[model samples]
Target: MSISTDHTQLQRQLYLLGYSHALPSDGVVLVSTLLKDLQASLDRVKELEASTVRLEREERTTRLGHDKAKGELHALRTENNSLRAEVLGHSREADRLRRESRADQYRLSKVADDLRMANLQLKAESAELSRSLGDCQRRCEARLSELDPRGKIPRMTVNRPFDVSRLQTHKTQVQPAIVDLVDLSSRRISALEHEIEHLEDKLSTSGVELKAAQMEVKERDLELMRMNSEYERMNPAQDVGDSQVPRLTDQVDYLHERAEALEKEAKDQREQFAKEKEDLHRRWVAAENDRVAAGDASWWRQAV
Candidate 1:
């Protein structure tokens, strides 16, 4: 019989307890054909057993491949999550740096403004000092001109005739002190001017530094924006999802559950196939035993 017919017969025998119902119409067949058919059935069983083993191996390989893919995907997701965290951290750091830079710039600008106000105050004080010194010099010159007459021993004008000698002695003593006072005022004015100039130079330097700092801050802001743009492009999904470990862990858990469900389904299929194979094997063994017993009974009857 053909392999297909043998397989059909075996299936029928497994379900119906015997293959007599499916016997061919050739009544002249030898008893050897029955033995040969039994041998073919056994061979088919062996082939089925080999095929089962190959299928089990393939199932195991497929399971292993599934597990490997899951692990790789999990690792990739973990790395992506970590990269997102790193990018967020960098963004926070950039924000902090920007705030600090702004604060420093504000303080520097305030200092520069204060310095400018102080410079204006110094200029006003210097002008006031100059005016006061000029007034003192004029007062001293007027006093000396009233007290002494140049190239004359003493002046006895009609209005100061009685006070000429007293005036000469006082003028000689006070003139020197007035000259000292005028010299001190001049020196003070010079010192004040120098201090104002120094402050102006310092203010100029501070302005230059502030401008450089502002430029640096602008560059940093541009760089930060570029980094943010790139990060957004690289991981737009990360931005859409909540940036938390819990959420990522939940997603991982969901993936693991899906993988486990697939694995469970595969395992269940293997178990069901094994159960069916075992049932078929048992039926084949019982059928073989029944055939052998019938053959023995027939031989014993013939011997008698």
Candidate 2:
């Protein structure tokens, strides 16, 4: 725009100097020089504009790549969160199972103690009953021997009376009572044994379940590790440039800032070019006016 104004001012000066009717060779040369400089400046502007367009395209592409990376990172984060939550749940379940297993162990130990005490009590009672039965058998035999008519066995010197009625009464009543006591002890022992066996089976089953839960938790941990590895591999920035995602993000921002700086530099260059072109236009017009005032100095010298 300044070039055109300068050109108009130059034309008006030529008209005022009475040189418009016959433009001197100096005027023609100056106009041609200005046109050439204008063309060159326009070419430089076109090149700068093309460079800006190219830079813009690259910026867009980089931005898209950054956005895609962010999306993938977000997805990985979401997957990681989900896996972490699942792992936490598994851990909680394992803890609960472990607590239950410990409780079962305590109960099993208590039951075993109870069984031991019962066995000891039963043994004591059995021994006591055996001694009582032996004493009753000996007494009955002595009483029967005394009742025999044969005088082969000599009686004791003590004049104590032999209670035949008591002996007969005890013989019939004590045998059945002892037999029933043994039977009842046997039944109680069997029942206690059965209960212990049942509890042991339950403990075994609990151990199996605990083992299974532990194995499952280990598998989940391995799976989560594998997923983390996969996610790391999928991260393009981490694999290629930086080891960290934040560093990659910062690099992208730097690129964008660099692109903006280039654009700003191009604009400044354009402004500088426009200023230089305006200065040149003003200098050209002054030179032409000076030559005309000097009565076309080059032409006069040529004529000489």
Worst 10 residues of 1 by lDDT: 156-165
Cα displacement (angstroms), candidate 2, residue 140, comes to 2.0
| Cα lDDT tens digits for candidate 1, 1-59 | 67556656555554565445544434224333665688899999999999999999998
Candidate 1 global lDDT: 0.53
Best by TM-score: 2
Relative to the true structure, candidate 2 reaches a TM of: 0.45
Model 1 segments beyond 4 Å from truth? 1-26, 30-42, 151-304
Write down the TM-score for model 1.
Answer: 0.40
- Looking at candidate 2, the ten consecutive residues that score lowest on lDDT are 156-165
Clashing residue pairs in candidate 1 are none
Each model's lDDT: 0.53, 0.58
